[model samples]
Structures are given as structure tokens and as C-alpha cells.
Target: MHSVNTRTLDLNLLVVFATLWDTQNVTRAGERLALSQPAVSHALRRLRERLDDELFVIGRHSLVPTARAMELIGPVREALGRLDDVLQGSTAFSPATAQRKFRIASGDFVEFLILPRLIQHIASEAPGVMIEVVPLPANNALPSLLENGEIDLVISTPVAFGAGLREETVTKVSLLTLIWQREGLSPGRFPLDLYLERPQVMIEMHQREGNIIDASLRAQGLARRVGVLVQNFMAMPVIASQTGYICNLPGPIAQAFAQTFGLSCHQPPIDFPEPELFAYWHARFDADPGLKWLRERIKECANTSDE
Candidate 1:
């Protein structure tokens, strides 16, 4: 690492460097930048002096970047991009006229609960907009994905991070008892003791911590005898319906699934975390008018959406 220079850096010079680095030739970079070749050359000289490094030197046909220039280029470009996003004034995105592809990382449960309504909203409002949903990876990749604009929105429980991301709870859910069928017990409502004593079914969304429900149970000084386990929450209704096993899950989701599958949702015996659904976006998108419009639309979709 070199010593930190106290002299102020020229923000404009960095743009020149980016263009020059991409073109590798002063004349072409100047053309791309709409500046005269000599003007670009003068700017480069100033930049080199300020940074105390020959950022680039002439080759036969193009300028080859030095190690230091390469090191500075990426961070400089990223910073400038962020600054540009910030400088943009607030404007609402109009979905009907807008064309965009919004990526989402979500569980099958979230998709099942929210996507149908979201798609309906998009169809009426953002017909040109596209959607690609990916299963949530068991990692903190959502933050960086948001930063890069790879993913537009992530709806889930809160995750820890600094200012790079913004999160807000859009809705809250209580825990519900999920039971498939009652061989002797008719499916109407479930007893709490039936949940604790009966063999439970669960799946871990985490890659490392096998079963999250089990861990949650242990947190409450209780553990379910997980009889059957599956990874996707969509399968929970199917599995529980046939096997008569009981599961504890988010109340709205449980109610929706239970109503669909001839199962029932009841209050649970023990205290459980109130599962919160969050809507989060990257700070990079804070000023994007189109993104701003879509965020409001999404929030509206969530509010009017059932379950």
C-alpha cells in the first residue's frame, strides 16, 4: 500500500482515467469523452501529479495502465456511480411505460404467498416489466446483489447490515399450528400438546444450521420430534396433509395453505417469534425514479394482497 495523499483529488480526472483505461488510447478516449486529445492529456498529467504515479504510459498504439492505476480505477468508478445515483432527484417510475427486469430472492413460501398478487399488480400496472425469482441462497448475498442492482427487492425477516441497505417491515405474522389430517382427530383446530407430543415435520433453509424450526424450538426449551423434513415450504402442506404431522409456521401462510389443502391453522401453545416480512432495497437505488415508483407499487401490492 502507498502512503495516503493529503492533496485533494480531482473527481473529473477519474472519469478521464476510466475512459482512457477502457479505450487504452488518448485520441479514442478523448473522442469518447467529447474532449480534445490534448485536453485529455493535460488532465492526465494533472491526475498523475496529484496521485504521484504515472497512472498510464504510452505503448506503441495505446497507453498501458500501471498497477496503481488499476488499483484505483475500480473503487473510483464504483464511487462515481454511487454519487450519480445520489445526485438524481426524486421521480416516480411509471411502470406502464417502463421496461425492466426485477430480480427477487425469496423462498417458495414467499413466492407462493406474494408473487401471484405481485404479478397481477404488474400486469395491470407494469405490463412491460419482467420478473425473475430465485430461491433465497443461505447467505448474505442479497445486500451486494441489491448494491449492484442485481436484485430489486428482498422480502424477508430482518438481516443485519450497515447503511448500504435499507429495510422496513411491511407486515407482521403470528405463529400458527399446522396439522395435516386427523386419523382419529378431525381437522378443525390443533391442540398445542398435540404439536409438542406428535412427530413434527420441518426443513432447514440454512445451509449450515440443519433445521431452523428445531433451533427455534430449542430456543423455547422445546423440540419437536421431526418425523418428516423437506427443504421447500411449499411441500409442507402436501406432506402435512397426507401424514397427519403438525408443524408450526407463519400464521398467514399457514392459514392460506391450510384453507387450500383441507388443513387448519390454530394458535400455538408456546411463545414464538412474530415473523416479520421486510422490504429492502440498496442505497444505490434511493434516487432512481423508476425504482422509487416500483417500490411504492410493490408496497401497495403487499398492503392490498391477501395473506
Candidate 2:
């Protein structure tokens, strides 16, 4: 087998070698790689001289690699992949002293309920870290965005995957509760039918497919006419404050929004499942060290907010 003079090679030559072997012709490889064809040809000549054999030879309008070139392909590709592995593996998040730009996307309720404390944490711990909160999308492709390096991380309860996606539960929310006039309602949880029938109001994302109110009502063979339809949780307090309408929302969400809107919250009279919030990442970043640090900081932020 032909051998290369290992001592006399620059590291980037391996990249040139791999590209030529994959495409065979230097001209085609250069075109594929956006290099001048002559540069690729010159690179190949240097590789041939350094290796003591022509790596490829002219064939019918193509270039055919020599036996040594074919033998080197697998190992060369593996080496490049390993290099990537070495470069992208670890994390550090000492928020008390970190400087980073963190991007997040979620509903306004989560913004109101959770993020205030996280911001405070950053202010104290990683004063250099800045938060860029994005408005919620109807159906965000967060996993893909993570892979493509668009958004850094996602925070929400709902998470699913086609592939290469992961979500770790950041927090589990309490069941939906009612936000009613503080003076009139019973002190404890309300009765389902009474709560449902008592001039109910619903808040839903405008672009969301269907509201839980509609689905739940249909499931139990019962339905309550919605007295109000608003897009954001921000309005739940304002609308529910003076009106007798009861707002059905996640306990934490209702409680938080109520503070802002001057309303109140309680467990619904009926039983319903609680929602969850999670931090999701793409597997592509599974080995990314910087990402690991970001995840930890986010987890810390979310966890500390609960306390």
C-alpha cells in the first residue's frame, strides 16, 4: 500500500484529501466545495507527491481513486467525526458569574409565572447573561431550531419528537383552577357543574388548534357556553376582576396572572389533569459543551423559581 509522509503534512490537507476521494475529480470536488478548480488540482498534486502515489487517475470523464485512497476513506471520515466529538462535549453554568445571551420561547403565563425569578437569578449570579424572550408560536419547531442553531432552548410543558429531540421535565403544573371575584366564591375548590355553569370565561391562544375548555366539556357529555374569548392570559385578570365570569387556567398561571390583573385563583370544582413544563434540546447538541452549561443554568433558573 502507498504510504504518506506523516511528518511533513499540514492538518488541513486531510480535508482536501477527503474531499477529493469523495468526489474523485479535483475539478468536481472544488466545485462542490466552492474552491477554485486549480486550487483543488494543486492540492491533489501536493497530496500525490507527499503520499508517494497518485491518489486517483483519469478514467472515462471521471477520476478513479487508487487502492490506497479507497483504503483511507473510512478512517479519514471517522477521524473527522471524532474531531467534532472532541470539540463539542461539555457545559458550565455558574450563573453567579456568566455572560451569555439566552433565547427562550413560551406562553405569557409562563413568562409571568416563572421568568421573573429567573431574571433575578441572572441579575445576581450571571450578571453578564442576557435574556431574549420570544413570543409564543402556534406550533413551534423548537427541536429543529435547536439542531439548526436558531433558538438556544425551549421552555414548555408540551414536548414530543419525530427524532433527535429530547425534553427534560422542568416543572409539573397544578390542575386548571378558577379565577373568580375574590368576595363571592366559596373559599375552597368549586363544584364542577356549578363552576362550569357559573358565567364561565375562557382564555385561549388565538392560533392554538382547540381550547381545553371545548375538549373537556365535550368529553364529559356537557358543555358550558363561553362568556368571553380572549387571546392572552394577560386579560384574564382584567376581564375577570369586575365581571362575574370564572377563568379556567393552570393554577400557577392563574395565580400569577391574577396578581397582575387584580383577580384571584382556585382549583376548579371539577377534576382535570395538570399540565407540565419542560426544557427541550436536539440530540445534535447532546455533545455540545456550551449547550450543557446553558441547560444547567436554565434548570437552575426554573428550579429556583419554585422555591
Error of 1 at 262 (Å): 3.7
Best by lDDT: 1
lDDT of 2 at 52: 79
266: Cα error in model 1, Å:
1.8
**What ranges in model 2 sit over 4 Å off?**
1-85, 88-97, 138-141, 206-208, 211-216, 256-262, 303-307
Q: Candidate 1: where are CA atoms >4 Å away?
A: 1-78, 82-91, 183-189, 206-220
Per-candidate TM equals 0.69, 0.64
The pairs that clash in candidate 1 are: none
Worst 10 residues of 1 by lDDT: 204-213
| Candidate lDDT values, in order | 0.72, 0.67
